[model samples]
Target chain A: MSGKVTNGAGEGTGGSAEGLDAAFFARWMRAAADAVDREADRLTELDSAIGDADHGGNMRRGFEAVRSELDEGVPATPGSVLMTAGRKLVSTVGGASGPLYGTLLRRTGKTLGDAEVVTGEELAGALSAGIDAVAQLGGATAGDKTMLDALRPAADALADSGGKDLRAARTAAEKGAEETTPLQARKGRASYLGERSIGHQDPGAASAALLMAALAEAGGDAEGSA
Target chain B: MADTSEGARVGIVLVSHSKQVADAVSSMAAALAGVPDAPVTGAGGLPDGGLGTSEEVITEAARRVDAGAGVALLADLGSAVLTVKTLLAEGDELPDPSRLLDAPLVEGAIGAVVTAAGGGDLAAVAAAAEEAYSYRKV
Candidate 1:
């Protein structure tokens, strides 16, 4: 494990014209589960510095549930796959991040409608909507030292490129996660630490970066199997 | 059987991560209200006894206490707050006029229960509960 979820594979970027389907979303979730499993210890260690130290475990359980869920006949549409995953995260994770991330995926999947497979343009819009929903749900923005710090930039990176360049999105997410190391806590439980939260990285952001890394891999933009 | 001077009272739902804490807080609030049967329900912990709140638990509790007036929802910390908020934002799962109170569990529950026991309306009950956010004990 690199202890960092970044653009580890730069060559196999999922092409711009890729049509994301249910299978693709299922694979993305599986990849996310695997990455989270690999990085759980590091995530817990970071959380211990300034958080409740359950981010890693909570995320592992949530994503592991997602993996098994998708394995059980992979929902009919891409939106359903994400919706299932989102529901699982909310029910099993039991924290701020779970609801936040759950709303993100649910809203995003909802915005995608019943499309069997969606073009990048539609996905871009849905992704942004999902991200916006998360922001509203958490009441935090890009600089709040939360997962949005990573998620917003990555979403922007993809949207700006017209939904191409998963590598760029992955890199942007990694960098955003890295940049949170020095920010004071402004949201979630970490915010309660006040000034003491400045040095530790945000576990939510780190997990979000792993999410993007998984997205890139499932999008066919990256290589290396989980 | 009811006096016209007594206004419509709202129901109160207390949500907490721990089942015991939720039940204790609700009971304490009811007792503090000096009302034997305040319309308050405690929706705490997952159905599986885990220390986390869930939408299902909250929804069921709200349904149990709802008397068609309204319901004031108070959640204690972290997932409890998130779970309640998520239900509120859904705008469909909870009762028609449910409001998620932004107040401490014990304090808010007492305030809300007292207000409801006194025949306060939904808005009044919610305001009273929220007022506990600034309630001074010093």
Candidate 2:
């Protein structure tokens, strides 16, 4: 409920911003779902090389369920919105992505607490907590050629950006995801491929980057509206 | 936890990437245990019938089979295990006494279901499942 907000210059001024509300969080989820839907095929293709070739489909199904749950009723607070989405994803999506991503959002939402409006600083902190939960649940770290490749960098960037500059966080996530292409996978199904996984981009990392991009896009739209 | 006076036993849920495999294993375990309606549930396959494990399916199966004591979950692969662990970590709608076993899927399912049918408690059933880890064909 209480956190510093950023002004148009992307500087924190210790006040609440109008755009950081449940509605904005809802838009962010929708945008991320759309991104997943748009890129599901590509994600699946990436998985085919080193995984079971189902990442795209799994993500698409998970986000679609999230979309439906959001449609039913938007929660009163940003934290609840994310918690609801996270639970829906955990119950609906199959495979490792479900648990990893679900933990990310659920832990983030829990960190957000009952705040109706959250500042970038609070959101960044919550996201860091969420990312940490994901890492703990999957036993994955950066350089594992997993979603953490993108998510860890994005969290660091978001925290460093003072939780206001979504674009900077998105860029960092994209770069991190790209950096995974040449690394050998050490976690999840891709690990089974061993040396063969060296040249492939990780599907989970790719999807994580897309989700960051969606966050950036949603932030931009909120700023534009404001 | 519910009343076990009527011999209500812990349930077992098998999580696998393939629906066919989960079904076959659970059915075989049920037949072997001679408990036709044994609390052995299969939570496998993607929603679209693809080769993956669904959290929804697992959650539903856990709810369906939980008679009171608790549920024991056995997963076939890494992701399946991770999914169940994540589900339990949430501590949301899942049955309170449930646990995930770190044992071989086929053998664990058999051991856990038989124990549950024999009115084993949650810990005992979970122990039965984990005991399958020492199973050797030799």
Candidate 3:
């Protein structure tokens, strides 16, 4: 449903005919939900090794909360849907994950705001907001070996690509996730372990990659259903 | 049940291992006005089981929200969950026990509370909370 930018393209805010819509957003979240449920144990295992052992449980409770919140009914706008999800995390998750992840979605949602349909620029802004929020919340710089290690590049690529389609976004996100392995810990729970946090990919960063994967899958599903 | 009135949204209480986590999440809410001002309220959990009973904390938090709006409680672990559960069971009326558990912490809580504040039903808000879980990485 999206056509390339024939109009002025420099500003990047011009609405895209193919940008993610409500259904696509829902599918993305659904994929995210599934990834969390499937990997809850692994996340906890990672947390147990370096950070607190509750990462799995913490994430489990957080996603379960999101499920309940969304089951109430599909939201009208993408921003509203994401914002609701973000707020619930802040209130219910109860850990660093709560704020970090919550801030990501909340800031992303805020960027989407009350818009009826989100364009590529808006989506890029939202994703960038999410990445920035995570960094601010976790206090992790680029080399910190946290979720930002993955998320920063993902957002950058999305903006650089101009939010063309899910394929490019997914590729960037996965690459970003993979990049975390070589970096040393500089902040967050992983940072506390110093060198131990290195070599082993950060659970949060891994999960962040999973979220992007889900987003790609969701977009595919939405297209398939359509 | 849907309420046309705006005052019926639930109040959100944030619980975390440290005050920093709570404050960080609360700051997100502060950025938006539709969700209750201070809808994100946080309490620090003391190690060595010093955080007090679940009932005590939830009841106190519940008091901040009106009966019409109700309240949703999200916590870290140990006594935090138990305390919210305890308060839900013993409180004058439960805000919907389902809302207490399995809801997504990050995306779920934010979505639920923001939606509720926007005049969404308890059932709807609760579902949104649960749906937030979908954003997680497995």
* Per-prediction TM-score to the true structure, in the order listed: 0.88, 0.90, 0.60
lDDT of 1 by residue, B1-138 (tens): 132234556889999988899999988999899989988989988788777777678889999888777888998887788877777777788888889887888998898999888888877787888898786889
Query: Candidate 1 lDDT, tens digit per residue, A93-177?
Result: 8667778888988888999899887766676688889999998877888888999999989889888877766666788889999
Residue B82 accuracy (lDDT) in model 3: 40
Candidate 2 residues lying further than 4 Å off, grouped into runs, are A1-19, A221-226, B1-6, B136-138
What lDDT score is found at residue A212 in candidate 1?
87
Classify candidate 1 by CAPRI docking class: medium
Sliding window of 10 residues with minimal summed lDDT for model 3 chain B: B47-56
Measured with C-alpha atoms, the lDDT of residue A176 in candidate 2 is: 92
Error of 2 at B101 (Å): 1.2
Task: Please provide, for model 2 over B17-129, each residue's C-alpha lDDT reduced to its tens digit, 9 standing for 90 to 100.
Answer: 89889989999999988977888988888766778778778888899998877888999986788889987887876798778888899998898899888788887777888
Among these predictions, the greatest DockQ belongs to 2
**Candidate 3 per-residue lDDT over residues A123-217, each given as its tens digit:** 87789977876665455688777778777776776678677555456566667767777777777656767777767767777778767766656
Which candidate has the highest TM-score of all? 2
Give the Å error, residue A93, model 1.
Answer: 0.7
CA lDDT, every model vs. true structure: 0.82, 0.83, 0.62
Candidate 3, B12-82: lDDT as tens digits: 66655555665466567545535335454555453223322223334455566544565666666543554
Instruction: List model 2's recovered fraction of native interface contacts, to 2 decimals.
Output: 0.80
RMSD vs true structure, all candidates: 4.7, 4.3, 14.9
Ranking of predictions according to DockQ: 2, 1, 3
Error of 2 at B105 (Å): 1.0
